[model samples]
Structure formats: structure tokens, C-alpha cells
Target: MFFKLRKPIFLLLSIPAIALVYIFLRNLSGYSINYQVSSPCACYKCLTDSDPWFNYNISENEFNWWKRLQTESRSFGVYGTTVANFFKIFPRNPDVIQPKPDHCRTCAVVGNSGNLRRSHYGPLIDLHEVVIRMNTGITRGFEKDVGNKTTHRVMYPESAVAVDDNTHFVPFPFKIQDFEWLINASTTGFTGRSYMPVKSKIKTNKDLVMVVNPAFMKYVHEVWLGNKGRYPSTGFMALILALHICDEVNVFGYGADSDGNRSHYWEILTNKGLRTGVHPGSYEYNIIQQLDQQQKIKFYEGLTKKM
Candidate 1:
């Protein structure tokens, strides 16, 4: 009778003691559910030990990478801020997004190689919110290839060509003296390398230069050369940049025609005997086809099919 009564009392005492010891050990261990506390770090990396400065008023539990991605995703097509700042110093004015519309913003990108002189796609190409062309090859003749709807023209401070003042002009400030050197070079009436002087001073009436994102450029090179196993050219990068910045990107006069003939769209004689100009290699073309298949952008080939 005495042993049976002691057994019931010992069992009751053992249950609470075990629970206390387990609680003590859990508090001691870092990974224990009852021990490891919430972190203060704002970066998305979790399961880390570093204690960052956490906002006391903000809800610690609410912060996460998913939340940040969602926020950043909304601001998706904006180009590099670093590139935009370079042009801020010269001709302090707002940059115009061409084919200017109140509701939808569209761009038509034109390349200079004399290929666009008479393609007659100019009026149709003008249907965009903005029309972007590089260098100064705009004329009414090659309307098909160059597109007559030139809204924005990109130029270097050192371009060896002249662009009409009435149209919107964009200067690419790639280097430190891009604005100063190019502007000075043009002002001083000295044509050096890739720049030509204007006859007279014209009013600066254009938006900021559209800058190439270094990160985006790296992404393109990596995707093409390192990942896709090919070298990407300047025009290929330009197309990629348009795809990233604009909502709807349409490519015209890029690469050779449908028959794999190596010819210049600009028709500038590069010694038809010596070397045929090339835009993209077969591997880069494959990557572009992949991008098109993924519906990342739309590519239209203005081919005569006579090759």
C-alpha cells in the first residue's frame, strides 16, 4: 500500500521537471524553435546571423524579398539612373520621349548605314509613340528602311555627321567630357574622329539622353557570349536595350536578308571585293530567335528576297 501511493506522487513530480529541462535546453540552442529570434537585416538573405539595423516602428515580420520584388517590378522599364545623370549637366532641359502621346509611349529605332534610304516604311514606322534613330542618316528617300517617322535621333558629341535642328536630338554622354568635349568640338568647328561642327548655334530642345544600362549590357553580353555561346554586336545590344526599356520593341533593317547574304543595308561601299559587312553571327541570330520565340520582343525583317 505504501509503495503504490509513492509511485503516483513521483510520476506527478517527474512530468513538470522534464518539461522545465526541455525548456532550458531549447532556450540555450540557437536553432531551437524557442531560441533563435527574428532578425533586423533588411536584405532578403535570411537564415543568416548578422544583426542589421532594424526599424523599431516597422513590422519586422512583414519585411521579405517577395515584397521588395513586387515593389521593384512596378518600376520595370526605367533605364540606368547613372547614365541619365551625365546629360543633366549639359543644356539643362527635359528629355523628350518621341512620337509623343499623352496616353501611350511608342518608339521607332533607326540605324544608320545608308540601308534605310528608300525602304518606304517611314510613314508606317511613324505609328509609334516615339521614333528613335541613331546617327544622322534621316532623309525622305530611304523611307522604307530608315523610316520617315524619326522622332528621336541619338548622336554622339563626336559624330562626324550633321543632324537637322528641328527634330529632337539626343546626345549620348558615355564619358566624362562627353557633353563638354562633344559640345566644344562642335562649337569650335573642328571635326575629329566621329564629330562634325554645325554651321550655327541651334537651340537645345530635347530630353535627356537615353543611357545604356551597364548592368543590362552585362546581362546581354553574359546571356549572348557566356550563356548562349556567341558574340553580340552593337546593333544587337541596341535591340536588347529597346526591349528592356520600351513596352513594344520592333526591329527593322538588322542583319542580312532571308537568304544569308552578307550585304550592308546602308549600302555604304565597304569594298564589295574585300569584306562583306556583318551584323550578327549565326549563334547570336539563334539567341535573337529565342528571344523572339519567348515573345520578349517583335522582330520584322524588311527583306526584298532577291538574294
Candidate 2:
């Protein structure tokens, strides 16, 4: 009886030991098996590696293509007048704002998922050469998890927030008025307001403001995302932008949180089913997972099993 009992006891203890080892190895790999997903198509590799991922120096032919698409696509009603005004406001391409780095650039694209609440990823995020945050993601109270540094803040008129003089304010214009707003905001303190009525005068330095080409937004939706959703969310567009500019990209606070709720890290909601209506959240998440598996980008899920 003693011999039989000893063997069972050893087997019970070994089970927990094996579980611990599995968790340790998963953490060491910096990716969780839970998030792994296969790509929708094999062409994904070729698409991601293709040239002109961004509108760095958009050629005349590309401009014509974008204009033709704008006329056909009903998602965004970018008028001819707006396109002309956009050109006048921003004659130079996005390359003008790009920094000439002597060495490889490592970028961190920080989203606002609830998973980042107590992640202690602030230090790691700040270590990157370029840090890109979006919309109204605050750091004053959540610095311990989200980091305080901001090299770039990507937003549209509706989600615009004031950045410091040092930080770059990248405006993603969706309408003609948005282009007008940027120019007026920089020059005349923006008396006119949009339908949403954004801040008339932001505190950010005028010279640091960079406007993303509406064409680039179209490229992200059509080419990169394969028109998965109504349109690519700001966070998704920002990720592609980082991939173009940075040598290596690391994503944080994207997808659902620990409990699988679609919510921001700054605010948690009880409704797990809540998701962005306009954006294809599930499809986008799958693509992100595929990119991680392909080693094209690193997706930091935030808080490994140890935490």
C-alpha cells in the first residue's frame, strides 16, 4: 500500500511542475499561443513586404489613382475642393517630417487597451527610439503602465488632443473641413468648427504638426487591410505607418484585455461583447497575430503569465 501511494503522490506533484515549465517557456518566447492565428491568405507576406507602403513621396500617377478611388468610394466623401485645399496646405509629402536617424529605429505603437492598466510596460515602451501613441491616450495618471514620452500622437479632428511642443501632432484628415481646420488651427487659432466641434486652438507647436495624406489612409484600407471593415481604425493605420518608418516595430495594448472585453485601458466596461462597429476588430486582430508569427512585427500582449 505504501509503494502504490508513493507513486500516485509523485505523479500529482509532477503535473503542476510540468504546467509551470510550460508557462515559463511561453513567457520566454514573448508570445502567447492563445493569440496565434493563421493568415487569411498566403499573399499577405507579399503585400506586407511590397514597396510604397506609405505615401512618403507619392508620385503623380499614385495621386491620380487615389483621386479616382476617392470619386468612387462612398466611405469618405473627400471632395475635389478639399483635395485641392489639402495640396495647398501640405505641398510637401510625409518624408519632410521623417527624422534622419543615424542608426536603426525601434518604434513602439501603444494602443489604449485595458490590458495595459497594470502592465508595468512603461519603461519598456519608453526605451524605443520612437514612441507612437494615438488619440486621447493619457499618461499623466497612468505613467506607470503607459509611459509619459510621446514622439508622435496620431489623431483626426474628432479625436484630436493637445501635445507638447516636442511631440509631433499627426493629423489624419478624413474630410475637406479637416484639412481647412489644420491650416486655420495653425495660423488663426481655428475659429471655424467641425460638426463634432474640436478644440479651436490646441496648445501644441504649429511647426510640429504633420498631416497624413488622405491617399495613405486609402492605401491602408485597400492594399494593407484588403477592405476588411468600413475603414481602418486610427490605431491600425498608425501601426502601418510605424512599419514604414521604423526598422523594427513593437505593438502594445491592442486587441481585447485580460477578460476578453473590447475596452480601453483607461476605462473598463462590463460588456465583453462591445466592439468597434465601424472597424473589423476580429479580422484586424487576426492579421496582427499573423504578422507576429511571420516575425514582421512583435506584438507585446502585456502582462505575461508571471504577472
Candidate 3:
């Protein structure tokens, strides 16, 4: 019966549906996507081992071999040889040697999930110096994911808002809004898009918000992501923050189940079909496994799924 009068009913529903879509689009809109970047065509020579400070301590023969490998790796189909070169950016403080904490910090990267409403992670999240979140609208029923202990909220303008003194806003420089944040960040770090809005918003002497340069993203991809050179989405971003800032980083509520199937441990609408993470593509499950092996991070794998 609904289909018998299909065209008329379809036209009737379209008006409200169109209005709803417009509202959704406004909410979703943010930085202009960079389309110029194609796949890495040649070795990114800028981030290379040939530089004067290319670890001169290693023997000439070993260094030569390493250089050869770097080039050959690219020729044969390898990427990311420059990941270790970040020390050049911020040379490690040899004076303050030990970075790994005696006890690993349990920092959670909370996802947007209504299921966390009563999960009770406020105090736990507060303990972490940083709690990375994405895709705002969090101040709602999901108390845990958008914990009261929100130390850092990293997003575009649509997501930025009044956080407490400790709550720092780290917005990825994508469009005009980012330009505004950059102006305000005492200091900022950029991976690529440096002309972000944050630059425009600076008025005082607040340090720049640390930016993970696009070059760094490429480096991270090479170091962690396989030769194809694709980067882990925001998951890698969180890991990179831990790698740079904290001695220990604890991950929570990530990954599909043990079956390696795509399913949200978080709740979903009954009418909707299953939706996978918009994060890094591929066996990030495998990548996370490697990160665990290296003791780089600890995943709070749900009790439902285990080793």
C-alpha cells in the first residue's frame, strides 16, 4: 500500500528529509579536504638520512648500507624509512633519560558512544593528563566517553568550546576555523596544512599548540603503517600523541571483537545497518597488535573479547 502511492508519499517525505540533511551537513562540515596529494610517487627526499646529522656515530660501512637500504626499500616498494628522524625536530633530552613510567598510565581515547552513559569512567579519565576525543556533541547522556575529566579536546572549530584551565584545545589545521584556533594556541604543531585558522587567532604569548607536521604524518605512516604508506586515522594520531607526550598510553574501547569482524561494542540503532570505524583502513587490528608487542600501548580490550 505504501508503494502503491509511492511517488506521492516519496515527495511528501522528501521535504522534511531534505531539511534534516541540511542540518546534518552544517554539523558535519569542516576543513576543506586536501585533494592534491596523490599516492607517494617518489621518496620524500626532505625527510632523509643524508642530512649532516644522520647519526654520524654509526660506522661508515653501516651508514652506507643503511642509506642503500633506504633507497632500495623505496625502489622495491617500501616506505617510511624516515620515521626515526623526528629526533632532529625535537632532539631527545639526553639529560632526562628515562621516559617510560614505572607504572603505565591508563589514558583512555573515548569514542562517542551513548552506551558509556553509566559506565562510570569520570575519575579514571580525569587521572589521565590527556583524554583524546573526536566528532563533538559529547556533552550528553554518555557521561563516560565525554568524561568530566576532559583534559584535551582535539577537533575543528565545530568541535572547539570552553574547556577548563587544563583542558587544551588542539584543532587540526584544516580550514578557516583552524585558522582561528591556531591564533590562540600558545604553540601549535602541524603535520601539513600550516595555513590553518589557528594562526589567525593568536593574540597573547601562549605557547604554540604542538603540531604534528604532515611530514611527520608521512613519517609515522612509514614507521608504523606498512609500505603502502597509508596512515592510521585518528587512532594513529592518539598513539603519536602518547609517543610524543606521555611515557605510557592506555587505549580503551578500540577494535572489533575477537572474530576480527566489524562491529561496534558500543550500541547502535536497530533500524541501521552495522557501521565500521572511519579510522584507519585495513588490519589496524594487526597494527594495534604490533604496538602492544612493542609495549608502546595497552588496549583495554573488553572482557567480551580476550587473548
* Predictions: Cα RMSD each: 22.4, 16.7, 20.3
- Please write out the lDDT profile of model 1 over residues 1-307, one tens digit for every residue: 0001010100000111111000111111112001024432221211121222211111112212212411322211121232233334333323433221223344455554333435666676778766667654545556655656665565555452444455555443333234334444444433333234432332333333232322232334443344343324455555544532344566566545434444555555555442223323555555555655654445555553433
Name the regions of candidate 1 deviating beyond 4 angstroms.
Answer: 1-102, 112-120, 155-160, 165-168, 171-179, 186-208, 211-216, 223-232, 258-262, 266-270, 273-281, 304-307
Question: Compared with the true structure, what per-residue lDDT tens digits does model 2 show for residues 1-307?
Answer: 0000010000000111111000011121122111113322222221122111111233344345544432434223344444445445443333222323234567899998888988999999999878999999988889889999899999987788878888878887665566667767766777775557787766666556666655565556655566787678888888877765665688998887777777788875867788788787777777777878766778988742222
Better of 2 and 3 by lDDT: 2
Ranking by lDDT: 2, 1, 3
In model 3, how large is the Cα lDDT of residue 231? Answer: 40
In model 1, the worst 10-residue window by lDDT is 4-13
- Model 2 weakest lDDT span, ten residues long: 4-13
Off by over 4 Å in 3: 1-107, 113-121, 137-140, 144-146, 157-162, 174-208, 227-230, 257-279, 303-307
lDDT of 1: 0.39
Identify the leading candidate in terms of TM-score.
2
Candidate 3, lDDT over the whole model: 0.37
Backbone collisions counted per model: 30, 2, 33
TM-score of 3: 0.48
lDDT of 3 at 291: 57
Q: Candidate 1, TM-score vs. the true structure? A: 0.52
